[model samples]
Target: MAVGQVGGLLPHVAVPSTMPAFLIPEWGLSYGEAGLMASAYAIGYMLAAPVLTTLTDRIDARRILIFGSLLNALGTVGFGLLAEGMVSAMLLWGLTGLGFAGAYMPGLKALTDRLAPGDSSRSVTVYTGAFSFGVGLSFLACQLIADAFGWRWAFILTGLPPLIMTFVAWSLTPVTPAPRAGPLLDLAPALRNRTALGYSFAYGCHCFELYGVRTWLVAFWGFVAASGGAPLGAVVVSALFTALAMPASILGNELALKLGRHRAITLVMLLSAAVALAIGFTAGLSPWLTLMLMLVYAFTVPGDSGALTSGMAAAADPRFRGASMAVHSTVGFAFTAAGGWVIGVALDMAGGVSQPGAWALAYSVMAMGAALGPVFLWWSRRSGASS
Candidate 1:
C-alpha cells in the first residue's frame, strides 16, 4: 500500500518542479499566479476530503481509494495534454488534488482497519513517513523527466503511476466499517473534541509552513544560484531537502514515544521555527550554509508529522475516527493551499522572487506559521485536559 502511495504521488509536485524552468516561462505567469496554480491541488483536496473521508465511517475505504486513484490519473494526464494556460492548469491540478483527498486518508483508514487490534502508532507514523518519501521522489522524478523529455511528458509519465495504485486498491481485502451512529457529515462532535482539534490545528500550521517552503524551495534555490551562490541543480536540492523528512519523521515519532508526544512535538516545532528565522535572516549569505540550513529545515518541519497524526488518532472517538481524520486533513490542506500562494504574494511584495530580501521575507512567513503550532498543541492539552 505504501508502494502504491509512492506511485500515486509521483506527479505530486510536477508543476512546481517544472514551473521555475518551464511552465512560468511558457505561460508567462507571475509568481502569484503560478502559486495559485500550485495551490489549486490543495484547494481541490480541501474541498473533497471531508466528503470522501467521512464516508469511510460506514463504507469500505478501498472503494474510495480506487476512485481517487483513477481521478488522479485523469487530472494529471489531462494537464500534460490539455493545460494551455492558468485557468485550465488550476482546474486540472485541482482535480488531481480532489483525487488525492480520496486516496490519502482513505487509504490510511483502510490500512489501519485491516490491522490486528493493538498499538498502530508506529504503523500510522510509518505511513505518513511514506508520504514524505513519495513527495521527495516526485520532486526528483518530475524534474528529471521534465529536463529530459519536456514538461508535458513529465506530467504524462508521472500520471501513469496512480493507475497502478488503483489496481492495488482493487486487491485489498474488503473491510466495511460498522454503521456509524450519527449523520455522516456531522463534524460538530469532532469540533468539540479539543484534544483532536489541537493536533489538527497544529497539523494545519505545520502544513502552512511545510508546503510553503516546498512550493518555493526550488525557486529559492534558483535565486541563490543566480545571486552568486554555488551553481546547483535546484530540483535535486529540493528533492534531498524533502527526502530527508522520511527518516526525520520516523525518528521524531520514536522520540515522541520516549519524551511524550506533546513535549517532543513542541520542542521540534520551536526548533524548526528558530531555524526558519535563521534561514530567513542569515543562511542565504552563503550557498553551503543555505544548503545546511535547508536540510535542517526539512528535518524540523516534518519532524512533528507522525507524532501529530498519532496523537489525533489516539484522541479521536473510535466511532468517528474517519470524520476526525476528515477534519484533520481538511484543515491541514486548507492551510496547504494558502501556504504556497501566501508565500508567492510575499515574494511579490518583497521585491520579487529574485531578490535575497524576498527569500528572507518568505522564510520569515514560514517561521511565523510554525511558531503558532506549539500554541495549538498547548491549548489542546490545557483545554481538553488530555495527556
Candidate 2:
C-alpha cells in the first residue's frame, strides 16, 4: 500500500513542483501557457479516471496496479524525452495524466480491498499518509535533483521510483478475483447521492486551492528569492513548507476520525482560508513573514484531503468502491485544472504590477474556494446523506 501510494503521489507532487518553471524557458511558455500545460494533464486525468476504474472491476487490481505504474513511468519518461514545443508538451502531459489516473485511485482500491475486514480507518490513515509523505518527498527530492542535475533528470528520477514500486506491489500484493458489477449502474447512483456530491464539491474546492498552490509555490518562492535578494534556495525553501505539510495532513486524518469528518474538514478549511487572506494582505511585509504565512496555509489546506477521501470511502456502498473512488478522482482533478487556469488568468491580469500582489490575489481566490468548501460538506451532513 505504501509503495503504491508513494509511487502514485510522487508524480503529483514532482510535476507541480518542477514543471511550471522547468518548461518555461525550454518551451518559451507564458504563465498562462504553463498553466494550460498543467491543465492538459488534469484533463487527461479526469477523462481516464472513470474508464480505468471500470477496467479495474474487470481486471485484477494487482495486475492493474502494475500496468498502471509502468504506464505512469513510461509517460513521465516520454514527456521528458519528447516534449519539445507547446503542442507536444500538452500532448505528452495529457498522456502522463492518463497514466496518473490509472495509478492513483486504482492503487487506493487495491489497498482498501486488501484491508483485514475490521476497522479499516487505521489502514486508510496509513495509506493516505503515504500519499501525503510521497507528495512532500517528491517536492524535496525533485528539487534537489533539479538543482544538482536538471529538470530532465528530475523526471527520470521521479519515473524510476514508481517503476521500482510497480514490481514491489506485484510481488507483495495478494492475488484476488476481479469484482463483479454493472459498470453504469455502479457509477450512476453515486452521482445522485447528495452527500457524495457535497463531498465532491468540497474536494473540488480543496483541489482548487491545493493544486493552485502546488503548481505555483516554487515560482512564487523564486519571485520572493529574487526580490528579497534572499540567499535561500527557492526550491529548498518551497520543499521545507511542503514537507511541513505532510505531518499536518496525517494529523488531520487523526483529528477527523475523532471529530466527524465534516467538522474537521470545516475547521481546516477555515484556517487555511484565513492564512490565504493574511498572505494576500501582508505578502510584501517581509520575506520570512510571507513564507511563514504560506507555510501555515499549506499545512492546513491539505491536511483534510485524506479525511475527505476516507469519508467518501466510508460513505460509498461497499460494492462500488472502485466506482466511488473513480468519481472522487474525476471531480477533484477536474476542479484542479480549473483552479490552475484561474490562477494563471489572475497572474496574467496582474501584468507588470507587483508580482507578489498578483500572486497574493490569485492565492486569495484559492482561499475563498477553501472557505466555501466546508459549506457544501456541512450541507451534505445536514441533508442526512452519506458522502
Candidate 3:
C-alpha cells in the first residue's frame, strides 16, 4: 500500500515543481496560468472523487486502483508529448488527478476493509504519512531527471511507476471482497453525521493549506532567492521539507491520539497558521534562519494530516466507509483545486513577486484555511460530534 501510494504521487508532482521554469520561457505563460496548471490535478481529483471512491463499496478497490494507475500513466505520457500551453497542461494534469483519486481513498478503503477493528488508526496514520515521502521523491525525481535529460523525461519516467505499481499491487495485496451494503454509493449517512462531517470539513481546510503550500513552495523559494538570501534552490528545499514532513505526520497522529484529537487539531492548526502567517516575510532574513523556519513550518502544516483521516475513519459508519471517504475527498479537494489559482491571483493583485506584501498576502490567504480549522472543531464539539 505504501509503495503504491509513493508511486502514485510521482506522476502528480512530476510537473508542478518544474513546469513554470520549463514552460514559461517556451510557452509564454504568466504566473496565474502556471498556477492554474498546478491546481489542475486537484480539479481532476475533486471531479472524480465522489464516484470513483464510492464505487469501491460495491467493487474491488484494487481493481479501481489499477484503473486509476492506468489513467495516470497515460496522462503522464500525454503530458510529456502534448503539453504546450496552459490549457493542455491543466487538462493533462487534471487527468493525473482523476487517476490519483482512484489510488488514494480507494486504496485506503481497501486497507481499512481488511484490517481488524481497532487496528486501522495506526495503520491509516502510516498510510496517510507515506504521501509526504512519496511527494518528496517526486520533487527529487523531477529535479534529477530534468537536470540529466530534459523536463519531459521527468514525466515519462515517473509515469511508468504507476503502471508498475498496478501490477505489483494486483499480485501482492489481498483481494478484498466488495461490500454487500445496499445503496453502496449513498452519502446521506455521512452527511447527516456530525462527527464524520467534522473530520471531513477539517480535512478540507487541511487540503486547502497543504496543497497550496506544496504547489507553490518551489516557486516561492525561487522568489525568495531573488529577493534576498539564497537557500540552495526550490527543488532541493522542497524535497527536503517534504522528506522531513513524512515523520511529522506519524508523530502528529500519535500525539493527537495521546493529547485528544480535538485539542491536538485545534492547537496544531492554529500554531501552523501562525507560522505560515509569519513565513512569507522571512525571505529577507538569514538564509539558515529562514530554512530552519521553513522546516518547522513544514512540520506544523502536516501535523494534523494523519489525525484528520484517522478521525474520519473512526467516526465513519462501517457500512458507509467508502461513501464517507467520497464525501471527505470531494469536500477536501474542492479547496485544493482552487488553492493555487487563488494564491496566484492574490500574488498578482499584491504586485507580483517584486513586492514582499504580495507573497505575504498570498501565504496569509493560504493560512486562512488553517486558521478556520479551530472554528470547525469548535462547531463540531458544540454540535455534538459522536467521536
Q: Which scores higher on TM-score, 1 or 3? A: 1
Q: What is the C-alpha lDDT of each candidate?
A: 0.91, 0.76, 0.83
Clash number by candidate, in order:
0, 0, 0
Cα lDDT tens digits for candidate 3, 1-387: 888788878876776667657866678766677778888888898899999988987877888888888898888888888888888888998998899888889889878877898899899988998889999989989878877888888888888888766875587556556447566567788788788788888888988888888877877777777765675888789898887777988999998989999899888999988888888766555667678878898899889999999999898888778889999999988988777778877877888766778878877987898888778878888998744
**Which candidate comes out best when scored by lDDT?**
1
A best-first ranking of the candidates according to their lDDT comes to 1, 3, 2
| Top TM-score model | 1
Q: Using TM-score as the measure, what is the rank order of every candidate, best first?
A: 1, 3, 2
RMSD of each: 1.2, 2.2, 1.7
- For model 2, residues 1-387, the per-residue Cα lDDT tens digits are 676667666665555666556777666677777788878878888998888865665666667677777877877777667667778867877887888787778877777777765656666766766766777778888778877888777777787777765876677657564557564436776776677678777888889988888777777777666667555666667667666666777788889878888888999999999888887777666788777777687688788887887788777766666777788889999998988778877888787224767877887888888999989897887888743
Using alpha carbons, what is the TM-score of model 1?
0.98
lDDT of 1 at 191: 86
